[model samples]
Target: TPVNHTFGISGGKQFKVGADNNPLSFFIVGSHGTNYSYTGELIRNTTSDGTIYQDQQGDKYSQNINQLVLGNINFGINKAHNLAYNFMMVHANNQYVGQYSGKHTESHQDSNDYTGRAIRQQTNDNLLFTHQLISSWKLSNKMKLNAGASYNRIKGLEPDRRENYLSKQDDGTYILTGSNRQKRFFSELKENDINTKVNLQYKLNDEFDNTNSALEIGYNGRFVDDKFEAVEYNFDALSGTFPIDNLQLDDLYNQANYESGKYTMSVGELNTYNVKKNVHSAYAEATYQLTSPLTANVGLRVDNVDMTVNHRVQHVEPGRESIKKTYFLPSLNLKYDLNDKNAIRMGLSKTYTLPQSKEISPYQYVNIGFASQGNPNLKPSDNYNADLKWDYYLSPSELFTVTGFFKHIVNPIGRVDQGNSAGLLSYSNISAFATVAGIEVELRKNLINRVNTATSKVNRVSLGLNASYIYTDLEVDIVNTPRR
Candidate 1:
């Protein structure tokens, strides 16, 4: 037989506004919100086989703020040519806090306990501008073009702390305690993008045969700089003083020493690291309708990525530095409409993931009697993906879709045990390859319609259910050992 218990709480709020003038309009809004929650659990078991027990507890709090402001104005000579422009800004912030604890006791009269805590926060801001020139030009036909550019900036921060304690008793009983603290890391990022596009349409017949197409190209470049720092401490203490009525005095003393001091070894560590990434990309896309039911769409994009890492250490050697080789990415997308109710889509792309800044940091930290260190020689992982998709309309309001995808990864990375160090286990990276395949299914239907009664109309009613499953397989070779 077993027993259990649990508890928790949460809450939040928001606000907004809009205004307009004859030839111009404007909108501005700002909002703030927060949420807090705490949870705890305890379990006890006892039976003919033995006695077992466990307990856990945790709490978290979060807060967020969002703001937006924008306005548009129009002015022109004789109103024949109108000049329109607008500017906008947005920002947000978030934070979190949490803690956990656990314990277990065996029938042999032995027991242990564990505990922990964590916190996190982030912030973001953006600014944008747009200008529109309205004019009609008659060359071979009528044409119009619109161009715009934007700038965005964002900042984020996160920090964390954790402590763990465990204790055991000769009667097979133990006690554990843990504490965690998180500091907000800080991040500053900026982006600039410029774009231009033109649209042309010509009248070809008396029946108003109009053919139209537009071409657009844009460049988006960004620079992101971030800093993260964390500190952690752990300690375990055990005491055994239980009297055994069935055991002799000498045997009790020996068992007490074994039960106590099992976790007297205490360890603490502090770590810090800095990372920056610079990314630049260019893209172009176009679409045309061959006919009413048959349409075609195509798009192409190219991306360039560069990243650098620097690490600082505490209570250890100075951290090392790592630079990632620049990477290039290209992608393609194609889609065709078979009918008003069906479509086919296909895509191919190349992508790369830079090593996590912390992974390349030469900093070393200790945890649970184990020490962890980053390898500065690690390299980025790369991948290639191709996919095909189909969409079908069972009815005007009901639809279903399916997609198949394949992804190939090179230099895949995973942690591998490097061995023990001073009674603590160490781990390092093991590069390998992986293959994945999966299927997706979806179904939707309108089960009921709103009912109108003499006194009042019933609100609209509908029901929906959806589910999906995915599986992955990986093959790897490490230290002459094959793994699957």
Candidate 2:
């Protein structure tokens, strides 16, 4: 892996008032970031007809500049009551430039690899704003209440343009053909979300067992709305011969200046879509000491999700998609202390992983050699997991642990190849069931711990290591797919 070059500047300030017991404070932070890099394979030389020829090299270039500002304010009415507010805003501009060798003749072309001279550029601008407010109150000596609400809004613009310049090659090398080919694509998205949550925690005083216990309950609600628009430009440029044999990043950027209208752009395909999501959830958890050296914790959560999508179709009725899903998740954890230096723990849980916005959106993302399309029919995956662990403490600064875990997953999602001329990449549910098992061990030891009183020099050295081996099996049909 190669690291990109980055430059960043950040500054913050804080103001506080009142005494330590009850204080009001406000803080603000701002940052500016800039990053750029060029990535590509090593240059290669090929010998043909007893002559050494340098193969055309491709480069992927990217740049990003962003500004982030965040601020927070907090105040306490008394020792038992407090309120806080936080807000953040981020603005960014990012660009990706991909260049590849152009296509070759049928006799010399390779289906699996990209050949030829082509350049593609995509630039996007993004803005995100978020705000949250929270309050904490001590209802009693054994009970506390906490509540918060948050709002977030995001806006982005994605625009792509590409140019292809090709000429007949007798010796497997490109020539300046002077024919200019260009295409443009543009898209935008605006999204907003609001969430509110309230939680209560109560302490259980077990005077007889002389142990600690607690119970917590919470409710949460969220609402979200997203709008998307995309357009492809259809234009006919004048056929002209150019003097340049090879295209450069600077040349592409100069030609595809949308803001300056360097090239004529016309609407070809127009797509409009919108999505709405609503979620409601409730959860409860309890932790209790079963014995003097044992403890157990159990939790249950229920969630209801409602989602709808509206996509405009050409020469047809509006395409409307909607779905409602509910999930009941439960988990249990148990711990037993054999002694002051050794302990055993066990856990079991059921969880679900939902598809993200880009995964479900009916959009196409194009690259130089490949393109990825989203699936609107994607479903969430479910997981049932269990784990057992043992821990041994050698000292405060050293310890060792070993764990074994298992997971059973249903409806897993993975990338699938469409095997087309466009080199299409799409996502789908590849397996009905899958199982994974793993064991991991970790150790941390301090080699040296000493101090020189007269010279005031101290040396403390430690070593930490961890490793895991996992085995996975999937029950699915793999016909006409690449083997792994």
lDDT of each: 0.48, 0.74
Clashes within 3 Å, all models in order: 24, 8
Best by lDDT: 2
Q: Which consecutive 10 residues in model 2 have the weakest lDDT in total?
A: 45-54
How does each model score on TM-score? 0.57, 0.79
Q: Per-residue lDDT tens digits of candidate 2, residues 1-484?
A: 4454444444444445566556777777787777787889333332222222224457788888888888888888768989999999999999877665634322122332334565567788999999999999999988999999999999998866555544534456554323234566778899999999999999886644533588999999999999988877644442333333543535533555645664454665577778888989999999888887788899999999888877763333457767689999999999999999999999999998766666666567655444577667777889999999999999977899999999998988766654433344667666887899999999999899888999888788999999999999985543344434
* Candidate 2 residue spans exceeding 4 A from truth: 1-21, 42-57, 102-115, 163-168, 171-181, 207-212, 237-266, 313-318, 394-399, 419-422, 441-467, 478-484
- Could you report the Cα RMSD, in angstroms, for every candidate shown? 11.3, 6.2
Mark the 10 consecutive residues where model 1 has the least summed lDDT: 177-186
Give per-residue CA lDDT, model 1, range 123-159, as digits (tens): 3333333333333333443333333333343333332
- Tell me the lDDT of candidate 1: 0.48
Model 1 spans with C-alpha error above 4 angstroms: 1-166, 169-213, 231-270, 288-299, 314-328, 362-375, 394-397, 414-431, 449-465, 478-482
Q: What TM-score number comes out for model 1? A: 0.57
